[model samples]
Target: MSMREKIKVAAARYPNQRSAIMPALLIAQKEHGYLPGPVLEEVADILGVERIWVYELATFYTLFHTEPVGLFHLQLCDNVSCMLCGSEDLLKHIEAALGIEKGETTADGLFTLSTVECLGACEMAPVMQVGDDYHGKLDAARVDVLLDSLRAIAPRAASVENTSSQQPGE
Candidate 1:
């Protein structure tokens, strides 16, 4: 679909044009797999807002990808609670398993490992978010299992146009 068509769909969903920013961004990301400058501007224009507004929204939210990211944007919480529960070790395991450092995407563009603050699931410390799903109480073994699960589901997810896909250069 064209960019205009995509923005239109997003704009139609909200009562206020500006309120559609998030959903519009999601649609833009679905089409391109990341929110590049052009996409952000396109969204802003369609919503009758300034480009900086869109840029601000993208930067403020960890969920939005300003640069290219992998198919799975893995966010591990490293808050005090999670750290006490061995989140650091979990982070190490994920980095090793994915062969990418934190805030970096795998060469294959399959995974991007990142560290986040509290995920609000301290009870399930050492938690990580893969795409929109959260996996908690993770050990190396469980992390491996989660990766496997993600791999298994990735193809299906990519086939759905609205679902997240691996970003280019990831």
Candidate 2:
């Protein structure tokens, strides 16, 4: 669907046009995989709000990718608790297994490795999140298994989705 069509759909759902900013941005991101400046402006235009308002919302949420991200976003926690539990080793294992450096996406755009301060799962230290799923108490072997499974499964899952239905804007 076109960006204009997405905006119209979002606008129809909200009581006020401005309230659709987040949902509109999400729709844009789902189509493009990230929030580019032009798309943000488009969303702002649709919502009849200032561009900065859309920009602010996008920048404030870590879940909203401002730039293109790989198919799998691997978020590893490196905070005090996770660090004490050997998150560094887990990070290295993931990097080596994926053949990509930290803060880098793989050549195939399959994976992106990123370190986060805290995931707020201290009890499950040395945790990593792939997409929306979390894997806790990771070791090298577990990380390998997790990546393999995700790589094998994600594409099939994505293909099975019915594109005709619009995803609800988170």
Candidate 3:
């Protein structure tokens, strides 16, 4: 189904139109990779809500990305629990390994490293979130292993992208 249809269906679930802002944004982001100005406006238009309302929710949440992001987004939890459990050191190690600091994507656009306030997995402190999966109780070794695995997966993801982008005749 089209994004507009998906948004309408999602909006139907909520009594208030504003409540559908998040679901609508998620649908838009999944279709566009990121929520650019035009895409945000389209979502607002489709929902029959104010543009500011869509922009407000899209910008406020970390899950929604307004700018382009890499194939893998590495989010490290830097809250007190993670801090005490050595997230600071882990962050440094990841920066060195990936050759990119926080808020930056790798040269190949494979990874984007970021530090979030929390992941709400205090029991499994020192956690890193790559996409939707959480790798917790992390140390240098675990992080290294995780990075290596993601690297291996990158080529397959690239190939999939290339395949999907090809025209039937071309």
- Superposed on all Cα atoms, the candidates' RMSDs to the truth, in angstroms, are 4.2, 4.2, 2.3
CA lDDT of every candidate = 0.84, 0.83, 0.90
**TM-score of candidate 3 on Cα atoms, chains taken together:** 0.92
Deviation (Å) of 32 in candidate 1: 1.1
Please report how far candidate 2 places residue 148 from its true position, in Å: 0.9
Query: Regarding TM-score, does 1 or 3 come out ahead?
Result: 3
Per-residue accuracy of model 2 over 2-110 as CA lDDT, tens digit each:
7779679868987988788888887788776789899898888878899999999998876688887787899999999999999998888888888888889999877
Cand. 2 TM to true fold: 0.80
Candidate 1 TM-score over all chains jointly: 0.84
Sort by TM-score, best first: what order?
Answer: 3, 1, 2
Clashes of each: 0, 0, 0
On residues 14-94, what C-alpha lDDT tens digit does candidate 3 reach at each position? 998889999999888877778999999999999899999999989987888899888898999999999999999999999
Best by lDDT: 3
Candidate 3 whole-model C-alpha lDDT, 0 to 1 = 0.90
